[model samples]
Target chain A: MIKFSWEFHAAIENYKRMKRIVEFYVEGFTNLPDWARSVWFIILLKLLIMFVIFKLFFFQNKLKKEFSNDEDRANYVIEQITIP
Target chain B: MFESVDLSLVNWSRAQFALTAMYHWIFVPLTLGLGFIIAFMETIYVKTGNPEWKRITKFWMKLFGINFAIGVATGIILEFEFGTNWSNYSWFVGDIFGAPLAIEGIMAFFMESTFVAVMFFGWGKVSKKFHLMSTWLTAIGANLSAVWILVANAWMQDPRGMKFNPDTARNEMVNFWEVFLSPSAVTKFLHTSTSGFVLASVFVVGVSAWFILKRREILFAKRSMVVAATFGAVASVMLIASGDSSAREMAHTQPMKFAAMEALYEGKTNAPLVAIGLIGDPQDDPMDSTAHEDFRLKIEIPNMLSYMAFLKVDAFVPGIKDLILGNKERGIMSYKEKIVRGYEAQQTLVAYKKAKKEKSADEAVLRAKFDDPQWIDNYFKYFGYGSYYDPDPLQLEKNAFTMIPPISLTFYAFHIMVILGGHFFMLFLAILWLLFKNKLENNRIVLWTAVWTIPLVYIASEAGWIVAEVGRQPWVIQDLMTTSKAVSQIDTSSVMLTFFLFAFTFTALLIAEIKILTKQIKIGPKKEGRKQ
Candidate 1:
């Protein structure tokens, strides 16, 4: 009973901390200056282009794309390094 | 030979990485230096309880926020390129390289981001003392982030504390502190961060000069100038010392790069440092000793290069010819010999792998060769040179010449950086003296000079990077991996497409940042009676 009660208190404390952090960021975003909105738009647009357009369509990791397993990838790299 | 691989793929990959890195560098130095300047302004505000100081701090802080956000965006792209563009290099040195970057992300970057929120938004919500602490911590965190990346870059320039594991086919870190505290790492970090400080100082002074020129905010401009000029002067002095130390370190660890920086073609004792000169076209052969006289016009500081490199005027400095060809008396192994030894090392690895796989008796002996310190230092150290090995004697000579970096680019970039460094040092002192005499506003030339220097400082900063990166061409990690060998086996078209994507996005974002920044500056700080 004692252990259960202590655990219950700890979980409640953790919930409060999580709530506080979320509130902090939410408030920060809401309170941003007028100019920051434009900045955020630029940042999000860049991220979208980089992650979606560039990374997805073009910049796939060659090792991961070519070989499904780590062993094969390692073997390929070793071959590349040693064959010359 | 691996020459059958598309050469264009390597060129495109290199061009893409350089593009991202250079663009990323544009915002980083400003963040590093301005963070501290803002902190100082806020400190004065807190100590004196002055509203004016707070206004100044807030104005600079606004600019810092713009730069910091863009810097983070570009920096993330740079990190991702390692996996996307240079996967082989990522795997080979990932063990040694990833630690610092991971630390930067987990510890320093997180700390910076968390506090940056508080520093930006906690104005009226948080206690004054807490806000001040957050600002200072943000500055420290920004700089701390720089320390790790510079350490990683230094490891590339002078690889240390790592050993190759044949089974894994990767270089693994043996000593973490050795990588962290390497002489190259120390000098590079000091030189780079201080240069950032100098750049930021120039930025602040330039902006402040504009306000004075327009005959608006006289007191505000003078106050900003005082702080920036004082910080800049100190940082510039340290920059000079660190640059000197960096040069000396380069001479020792990266002799090829150091030789290229000065356009030295012939090895000699008491080498004269080129103060200014017009370099003619590179000779048909770097081995031609008479090529030194090809400079159209020249001015030199006698014995300074030798003294700067080795503290002794009579110390022998090897040149391009000596490094590429042989210098038996100086004990410098030629590229041809290095390639031969490197090929042997590569063959030895291939044999060991075969033996181990077959469970042969030779496995033990071949594996022991890797474990032997002398063998590793002498043979394995030149492993990357194997890529240039050719069976034909004439082709071998041609391959050796390819080891010479773009001498013209390196030399011009280095000299431009040095000249600008000297100019900034004097400019800062002059500005401070004029301000002290209360003659700054009347002297339109000085004000115009300060205003113009903003762009020049950026040029100077970029030039410094060009020298560091371009001077060490043909190497990704010194003596271990060549740039061509380290690139991912990807199609040139894919790399080119992404390069354009990044180019378009970064340019657009840069324009946005400039527009937003100028708009804010034009609006100026909130009036004295207004709430921040």
Candidate 2:
């Protein structure tokens, strides 16, 4: 009972630490200087273009979408490997 | 069912990946090397208690921040490409390949990101010693990230410590340390990181030269020059050593690539290195074969190639023709023979899978071959080459030549990089001498050369990559998987569209980076009471 209580308190401490770190970064980004804000704009724009436009419309894991399960995916890959 | 692949799709995918990788490389090396340079400047500032040093450190740190922010997500796109364009390759070796990548993300990136935050934002808030420590940690963290990525790349060049699991239709890692500490990985990491250091040194010297020429902040320019020149000179020497090690490793692991780089066409002992040369193009007819291409004009260093490749003056070096045709006396097996053995290996694997599905006794017998080390060494090692096997003799001969990479591109790229490296070493030495004598300001010739060398060093860095990547054509993983076999079953038009999209986005980012940096340079360092 004592060990469990110690472990629970440690976990709570870690969670608090994590929250502080995330909050620090959020504050940093929100209050960036004018020049840095331009760079941040580029970063967000690139990520949006990559994850939203290109990935959503053009790029997909074909085997996962076409084959429903591991067994089917394996069979398809096996055929591709074996047949040249 | 998998008879034909769209050749255009393969070409487009390769082009797209190359574009992104080259663009990503531009920002990464600067980050890798400049991080250390910044840390060094900061350390001096702490030691001397000089605000001028602090001003210099802060200026460089600002430039680093711009580079670090813009370079983000460029590499992440490369990871995504592996899944989206080369799904077969991911499924086949993802077990081994993904481990290093995951570690790079979780450990190296985390360390870099966290400490970098403290380094940039903790200036006044944190203690002096703590800020300095954060700066050093950020540099180390950035380099550690390169180590993992390079190890993964080296595995593709010289694959080791993995087993192909027929049951899973993929390769699995059997030994972690063997993959991590392979000779290729060690040499590649050392060579690549040092080259980054050299490039960053050149960047600093060049920018400082521009300031000196403008007669702006003379003391600051000279001070920065002293550090970068000394650091770069040491790095340049290390670059030569690591470069020599890389060449030796390449000779042992990728002989065909070595041969292509030299444009050698016949196997011989006591081969002379081509110091400079012009090469004629190969004829269209595959069978015309009278030494497919020949040197037009050349200067040779007698017996140097053999010595360089094998540490023996008379050691036999096989060339493009000998590798394709096979040197029976040298015990080099022909590509035709490899294709046959690879076909046998594939057939056995197919038969084993079929028997397993039907619960036949033959499954145990066939599956035992994959388990046997001898069988695997002889045949399964060449399994990917089986895709080129054809019944027709003419086609077989043609397929053999296809194993050779484009000779001229590889040769020229290698030579250009070497020549530029020599120039950089000399340039660094000259700058150090001039700075010591306090003659740097008046020497227009040396200062202008330093200014022009900025773009040239970037060229040399990119050429080095070209030699590494282009030289390893046809195979995504040497002998284990060819590029054609590794590509995804996707529409060519879709790949083409996305390629243009990435090209536009990356170009815009590059322009933005240059503009912001130029503007900062013009603004100069903040005056005593003036806002930056």
Candidate 3:
């Protein structure tokens, strides 16, 4: 019984190993051009750069400007009333 | 997969959103437009020193208060819908969409709610100037709220100032200014705001006309009419102009939608817009000679469709058939196909569970027989199997019964809104003429006409929204995502239960609002000579 169970486990392990080998073989032949890979990397870098620039220049500034305008207007009015 | 397509869940979601949005909108426009009416009335009272104007202001203020209370309640439900029905969409676009909503809560809501309390209850407690300031601030807050909400909606439609992040499976904001300054955003904002102004003004005119007809509170009615009519006339004219511009912008940015609105079946250099026609079954292919038939009754204007769609009478409008064929040839499935596939997948899972327990003569044969492929094939055949040459039964079933809304309702609704808008402009002018001639107060016919026109305001609003939203069916975001794909993975029962609860609460609040408004109208504004 022990010998039979060991044989069954071995069969399952071999099946999984064969499946991995077949998948790797299929993937290895499906090669992309080096230029294409490089282009993809470059595109990713460009996107990252664009994201940073947009966050720093647009989103942050707009929030600052909106809040500042309200604060400034309130302060100016208060100052005018106090002086008068 | 052989599976039964259960559209119950998707249908329920659509119904829930539509009901909530429609009900919320009924109150929203009133708040925006009536806020201005109140501000204008208060301004008149402050400037002219006419006690009659003051009485008129107070009378309208009561109605405005009732609307504001209900509007806030409905608004809370609207915000919750984003998380409930559209959880996935909220998660995806939350980075961008959440900004405007949060700003609305922080900036617009707080400003409006705080000042509204002052405007309502702080008449003598605060200084007169301060109270007046509160009224103006409330109006500003309401308009500002509208601005932020429109900005968010326009972004969804146009997707400006955002880019897809594959890692997050979402679109994130790129430039705040680009989002704010989108052509769709600006046009939609102006058109919506102007429409609100018109609606509010019309309400004031209608109620004041009723009072005039009754011959009670003549001074108050007359004053209210003058203010409402003047604003109504200006807003009515501006609304027409803005609406025209909005349509033109839609033509350039969303040509497919523009084409759908006109029900254009074939691309043409000079398209004659169908003013009135019964669009036959849209579920059938427009190119299928027997499927789509138009019974044309009258043409309102020649080459109007061309002008509205292309800003030029000669520009081409691509029809639905062309769009569908083009997408198919390009290997890009329609939004409806994607949604249907989702439903098919869900149905297949259910079938798999049911088949899991059954035993048959041969295990392999039974498995194949009970598989999802058979039902999927039947579904495809039912929808017309020859539309695509792909023999895969699974794909066919997945794409079966996938169609956008019928073009007839959309086309007619759009035309009705435009025609009514034009007629209202003339009506406003005519009423203004009568008022100037000093016959408005005594002219029962004109007063009755004004009173009756009140319901048309609501109709026009509903029709306009139907055109704007329904025209872009199957897609929550045009060319990017489908509404089915955007819906959250939640139990339909939960949504259905909440839907019933919301409907009940909304109806009860609506009844309460009407009761309060009618009571106030009967009171008929305080008389000038009579002591409070």
Q: How high is the lDDT of residue A11 in model 1?
A: 100
Q: What is the per-residue lDDT of model 1 for residues B84-156, given as tens digits with 9 covering 90 to 100? A: 8898888789678899988887866588988999998788778889999999999999899889989999999
Native-to-model Cα distance after best TM-score fit, residue A79 in candidate 1, in Å:
2.7
Query: Which residue pairs in candidate 1 have backbone atoms (N, alpha carbon, C) closer than 3 angstroms, thus clashing?
Result: none
Higher-scoring candidate on TM-score, 2 or 3: 2
| DockQ category of candidate 3 | incorrect
lDDT of 2 by residue, B400-442 (tens): 7777787789999998899899999999999999888889999
TM-score, every prediction: 0.95, 0.94, 0.73
What tens-digit string does per-residue lDDT give for candidate 3 at B1-532?
A: 5254444776677778878787888888888888888889989878887766667777787678767765564554556666556655665574688888888878765898678767755655567678788899998889998898899888776776775432233467879999998988998898999888888887888898898888887767777877887888898878878888888888766655676677775666667877666665444432332234355455646777778766888866666555543354434444345334434433333343334435434444433432345553433111211222134645443343244454777788887887777766776777788878878887888788778877888788888888887887655665444566556546788678767765775676666667666776787676654432
Give the number of the best model, judged by DockQ.
Answer: 2
Greater TM-score among 1 and 2 belongs to: 1
- Flag regions of model 2 displaced more than 4 Å: A1-31, B1-7, B285-288, B528-531
Candidate 3 Cα misplacement greater than 4 A, ranges = A1-84, B1-7, B278-293, B327-403, B528-532
